[model samples]
Target: MNSTTAVTAASPPTRSIRWALASLSLSMLLSSLGTSIANVGLPTLAQVFDASFQQVQWVVLAYLLAITTLIVSVGRLGDLAGRRRLLLSGIGLFTVASALCGLAPSLELLIGARTLQGLGAAIMMALTLAFVGETVPKDRTGSAMGLLGTLSAIGTAMGPSLGGLLIGEFGWRGIFLITVPLGLLTLLLAQRYLPADQQQAKNTQVAFDSVGTLLLALTLAAYALAMTLGRGQFGVLNLALILLAGVGAWVFVRVEQRVTEPLVRLAMFHDRQLTTRLIMSLLVATVMMGTLVVGPFYLSQALGLGAVEAGLVLSVGPLVAALTGVPAGRIADRFGARRMTLAGLLVIALGCLLLAVLPISFGVVDYIVPMVVITLGYAVFQTANNTLVMADVQAQQRGVVSGMLNLSRNLGLITGASALGAVFAAAGMRVTFVVALALIALACRCARRH
Candidate 1:
């Protein structure tokens, strides 16, 4: 062999520009598919396991809670270790967990398996963005982020339909089975195509804040419990736990201030831009995520659609969201996140207005139009927020910050779901949508000022 050939063979090649983007897209798609696929399987799992509605709800809740809680922690951890290493480990764990979930005989076992799968998902998501940051060229970073957002949106959009089909044909196990090969493919692609960019952060002396992590987890858990249980359901013991959690959160804040390397950097909130943008993102996710739960129920119950049909229609928003991500990110990079976010909020408000005004006998076109508009708005808002969040932070801090964003949005989703559910029970879907629209309008005001 020639000397040049020999040299090339021995050394790692520089990343092909497209490969990094391709890898990022694939990883995100695989990770997102897990959430989407599970939603479809929920009904089937409930039937097969003979679970009550409340018990079956845990199947979705467990997954969301686990991923939401652990994502930031895992992201911070990935910085100390290696993104690639953590990414691979997460993929392997997720794949195995998916397989286990498929085989689970009992509802309890399935929930447990799903929780493990969520842990893996947290790792994968944390690394995917960090990986993009490290690997992609500066000009292309926004586009990459956009594409990642889009893929995730697509996965979410497709989730119900995919789950419905698989459940219909092969049973609930099919949902878990679907993720297995896709995850394996992602792992293989990552191994081959991912850049060899492993720049460990300099402060090896820095340690993870384990105490703070535990306290924060407790705080969120307490809040979630309070919301889920409601005041009526909470016993004396549950009330005490909630109080304890409040105390823990206060302690967590104190502990975080003292730590050299905190799991959540309290200082990031000091920036007006970062802080306001974060609030907007959180609010949007909360309202939008909550709306999703209502959509399926309304379509299936009030509109007389089958589960599969309802899911398919429900997927429209997410699909549009995914498709819009890259373009939104690109625009944010060029014109600034402020404008993109404002426009998105406005569009979302409009979509909600459309939903509120729809006739009692409105056809598919009526619903799909509003859903698509809302999703497109969601894509723009999310992409812009993501870009802005990462823009000011240094490379070394990206993982932790990224994790923080994930935590914020998930918290919003959890809160929205619980709060909106309560609202739905007390009032009605129409009132809930109208109130949510007003909230979105408030968010738009915030976005405009920001």
Candidate 2:
């Protein structure tokens, strides 16, 4: 075929691209759904495994650790390889791992399977935005992102209620079992309908940076461990891990600068807009994760609500985010990302401020109102912020950028999980909200500078 004909065929058709998005969304939903399912299932898992609460916590920790460690390297791998191949392979791995997780007879085996599930999720999370953005028309980028974000929110919202029902009916393993069928369906749809890969020339030789990959993985893993263990003043072990992470990070940067094919582009760090968005992503994750951890306890303790009642109250946020995200995406496309981001931050700050001064009252509205406001603001902010992060990046680097975003999220998660326990211990639950309010306000100020 002529060069012109080849180029034309390489571009995905609109209908097929939309199908790919649908499949990708399902894939994304499967990955994200696991993130929160374990949160609700932790207690049931403990009972089933005959383990302590802390021991069973490894089920969730293992997954988060694996995803955070490999995401950056895996993103670069996707760029060099055929993303279509990697994406489909990820779905397969996740499905197989889900089965393993369900069948595992011990806590150790379940944790190991959960780790594999994280590997699968890292592959999908790294590629989702880049794959969809590359496939869709530029005019529809915002809409596609909105749709993707909506599925993610839906997955998170489904986890608690779904896990509760599944565990109650079929035991703790039921949560993992349900994903098998849904994942199989998504795999079939993706394999049949996703666009063909446009690989590099067969004669060209490209090398993967094995050393840099090792350094990066060590750096991220060490850092996550240190932060997660830093529940209070860093102990001797935590301090040592933190120092090891610092050394690994320094070496990783040095290695990336020297490698012919670096795992991450050092120059991407120089892009002001990208850097700001990545930082904010980390901050947002920390605040949101901490709020999620603390909120349910606050509701039950403060309002004397049941497990079901607290779950219902927590549902309001994801519901709002799912409802608001697509419209926010559309608005970003029309009015520009910067202005929309500023507006969203202001709204979030307002919500946070309200929560900071929340009255001790019988009204459930006190908790429900701020949760909805913050989530709506978060949806608007995310719609605009995500667009800006990708605005200055190359098509090839989009996968890596997505990984960076995900990396920040995991950092925030580990940070929130580790640090907030200390705060709650020191200042009590309502004070935790006050602290979150302060952080949100700080993030709002940072958004203004951007």
Candidate 3:
């Protein structure tokens, strides 16, 4: 291939760009689907491994923790190494992990495999946007991003139901195996149609932040481990893990201060607007992810529904988000993002309260109604909340801020699933819902700021 035809960040031929976008979108959808779909299998996993619901939740918690911790580091790695090379490696690793997960005979093995899967998912997420911008024409980049966002919505909406159906027929292993062929297809298209990253002057000169990476990873992983195990009792193991997290955080801050190129810029926190946006994102994620993890258990165990039935009921929230997201975007543009965010958080609080206070004798429809309401609130707030963050940041820091925002989101997912799982194990589902409601109300207060 001549230099003219070689895919570089600056420019590439138009003929194959469409295929590249499609492949990238598929990768994004695959990562998004990991959270939505795998959640449906929680109940089945609880039964298969003869584990408590809280224990099986490590399946989800470990995955989110791995992704959240590694995502920004991977993004930096992709730049130092080739973005295309890292993307391919991620896809390959994810494919292998999925197979391992399918064949795993024990819960511990499955959680370990899923952590590897989380790494793969993080690599894919780190580069998808950059690749899209490099490949898609700048003039039409907005349209391309919109398309990818839509795919994410559709995948989120359909994942639980599809996963439910897969598990019901083929068992939980089917959920992991289903990605194998699709992953292979995407890999082929990406290799053939995507451009290679051309070695650049900047990449050659910059040193990778290995120390910062280790410290941050330690901080996140230790904290995640502590929360996942801190359910009913204040055990020695939990306390030790928590102490490790504290030490890691302290070391991380010191390292970040000394590093030439830190993983996160502390100066960015000076932007009150940006910090608020990130907090709001975290709150929104807690609401969404908490419901997703808790909803299926309440449905399958409490309401006497099967996995397929729970999935169908759980899928409605995302479906409603998909239906309302675009309209909400338009409304945000017409009115304002703050108003939409406020309205959305209020609705979410209301939905949480409804779920927490509902009579024990409630039916399937009762569960679904609150979920749809919450989902509608999510769709309404997401665009507005994101717009506030992106609009506030300097163009130079957008990439960093965006990564932090996403990291916040993944943390929210873990918080909802793991921390709340512990609460569920000790107190019960309604109490967990009440805790989430409190978070939502606090987020609403954050939204009220400038």
Candidate 4:
């Protein structure tokens, strides 16, 4: 039998499928947790290492940069190699790196270890989604996507509080060390339960695209640095980096078009549906980041709430997201992903419009209500969009496509952090949400067309 038939035949039983999904969900959680957990420990790290804020921030930036630059490349590598094997390797690497991070004696060593950990995270993030199609029935793909989404949000939401507690109990090292046991558990489950790769024979027929991978990685690095450096203040250096990224992207595209086994097929962009979904993902992510960038300031500066109160209020969005994710996926599975995608976009647009127009005199309730709407909508949009994108992709291409989906979201987050944060700083929350509204409107239009 062929690979497809083999994959179908190898589908895990119900109990095994649950174990496999648990592994995938934990993988997603660990990767996302790595992203946010370190943020909460930056100040502690600065104090412990006697490093300046600028130097210590690299602890977070190094991880972010590594993941952003290498995610797509690693995903393509998994497509060429066996995903199960690569994913197992990734989990092991992450676990070892986490231990190194916890034991590092110098700040530089910690940062270097974090970069390694991020590489592992890049693999985990890319492959977990790819594995869904292999592990789950086609009709349950939406539910699987939703569960991953929910775990991701939980990880993000849990990071700050969990990191704080760990730091208080065991110091900054605890934050990194906390994931070690979880990583091992995930590795064990995945190894025993996930369907084995049947593509080793086919893999021998294709050559890995080293040139394309390198060019893409370098281009992504330049772009991420351009968007993340300067602390939201655009400067000559940022401009230069942006220009470098543009040039690198042009070169990469040319290389991709020539490579026998391109990292990303240039022809994929020609698919209107895929292109549209990617754009919508980017736009929605940008708008979602706006709430994160603008929410705290709006709560504190505008409404005069204290830090703790503001944090409590801010947590509501992620809470709503976690609650809504599974239901949203089920809805997508039942009603259709395309329709749910459009509906979700429209809901987000309405919430943004309300945030922009509502009077401040209405106070915290006004903010909370709209944010709940936006978060709920975002949960639905994310699940439906992911389901729609992954549903039709070829099995061999799922890893790369999943990586692209993630890459778009990362770019959007970086852009929003820099661009929308700047907008809020200059023109205030109302204007920022107005910009967000415009973005969601564009996303809605794209969804409609799709």
lDDT of 4 at 399: 85
TM-scores of the models, in the given order?
A: 0.88, 0.93, 0.78, 0.98
Residue 341: error of model 4 in Å? 0.3
Best model per lDDT: 4
By TM-score, who's the top model here? 4
Query: Which of the predicted structures, 1 or 2, would earn the higher TM-score when compared with the native?
Result: 2
User: lDDT at 51 for candidate 4?
Assistant: 90
User: Residues 277-392, candidate 1, lDDT per residue (tens digit)?
Assistant: 77887788888877786787778777888966876687677767866888888987788776887888888898888888887587777688888888888888888778767755
lDDT per model vs. reference: 0.77, 0.81, 0.76, 0.90
Model 4 stretches with alpha carbons more than 4 Å out: 1-11, 200-203
How do the residues 62-175 of candidate 3 rate in per-residue lDDT, one tens digit apiece? 788888888878876776677788889888888888889899999999999999999998888777755654565433444454455556788877777788889989999999
Residue runs of model 1 more than 4 Å from their true location after superposition: 1-15, 197-199, 229-244, 300-309, 358-365
- Arranged by lDDT with the best first, the candidates are 4, 2, 1, 3
- Per residue, candidate 2 scores C-alpha lDDT tens digits across 373-446 of 88888888887888777655665676788889889878987888767756876787667767777776776777
Writing each residue's lDDT as its tens digit, candidate 4 over 337-379 gives 9999999988998899899999999999889999999998999
Q: Could you tell me the lDDT of residue 41 within candidate 1?
A: 66
**Ten residues in sequence with the least summed lDDT for candidate 4:** 1-10
Worst 10 residues of 2 by lDDT: 1-10
- Residue 172 in candidate 3, Cα distance off native in Å: 5.8
Selected candidate, larger lDDT, 1 vs 4? 4
